[model samples]
Target: MKAAAETMPTLRAKHVTPHAFRHATAVHLISAGVDVTVIRSWLGHVSLDTTNHYARANLETKRKALEKVTAPTTPGGQPSWKRNASVLAWLDTL
Candidate 1:
């Protein structure tokens, strides 16, 4: 810690720890579109719920998901399923 502080003065006053580094790494991985299950395995967490703690989506992530939901399924405004009567009937059964 002393040697690192000598070269980088900014870190000298900050209280950084191994756990802080681990948390930051997790958040970065999540932001990079890595799967949460993969992150859980890498972090050695036993539960997916624990990993979900680090998977909270930021505004950008939420916006991307919303865009996917609102985006057209086909180049035309109509959905592909609407063109297929059997598929539409199957969906209606649900």
Candidate 2:
């Protein structure tokens, strides 16, 4: 720890641990589309619930999910939200 800190002042032995590295590995595997079950086993977690906490949504995942959505259309030229008077009133209140 002393030798590593001497070369790089920013490097702290206490800041990095095996569990932190495990978290990095889990995030990387998740970003690469690895299954939750697979990750659970790789991390040797006893329960699927423990593995689920790591499955957080980031900006990239949200953008990809949005890309799959089909825009809603009403019979008229305007969208359903615009056509509904109640919705328009609610928006005005906001």
Candidate 3:
């Protein structure tokens, strides 16, 4: 298999493995916004619990998620953190 892989430029003879391909497929599907339950079924996972590991957000994904969110503000239209700063600081000390 290694020799055959070497003849094919795209195949990394030393690095290719079934698990790597499966993992890559999972990550690709996740980035494409495929549902976790569907991904689990596609990967032949017996339970959604097993698929949760692949569904975890990496730092880049988390950053993108945070970017999409609006910061919390009080009814007065001021950012909550601005009003709470002193109280939060006191709580932190405790």
RMSD of 1: 6.3
What candidate 2 gets wrong by more than 4 Å, as runs, is: 1-14, 73-94
Residue clash pairs of candidate 3? none
lDDT of 1 by residue, 1-94 (tens): 7889999989889999999999989988998899999999999999999999999988877887887786545756678778889998999999
Q: RMSD in angstroms, all models?
A: 6.3, 5.1, 4.7
Model 3, backbone clash pairs (residues 3+ apart or across chains), number: 0
- Residue 12, candidate 3: Cα error in Å is 4.8
Worst window of 10 by summed lDDT in candidate 3: 8-17
Task: Summing lDDT over every window of 10 consecutive residues in candidate 2, give the lowest-scoring window.
Answer: 9-18
- TM-score per candidate, chains pooled: 0.59, 0.60, 0.64
Most TM-score-accurate candidate: 3
lDDT of 2 by residue, 1-94 (tens): 6787899888864688888889988987886789999999999999999998878877877787899899876688898889899999999999
Q: Candidate 1 — worst ten consecutive residues by lDDT sum?
A: 70-79
For model 1, the superposed segments whose C-alpha errors exceed 4 Å read 1-8, 63-94
Residue range 1-94, candidate 3, lDDT tens digits: 6676678866763677789889988987887789999999999999889998898887777887889999765687876765788977987899
lDDT, candidates in the order shown: 0.90, 0.86, 0.83
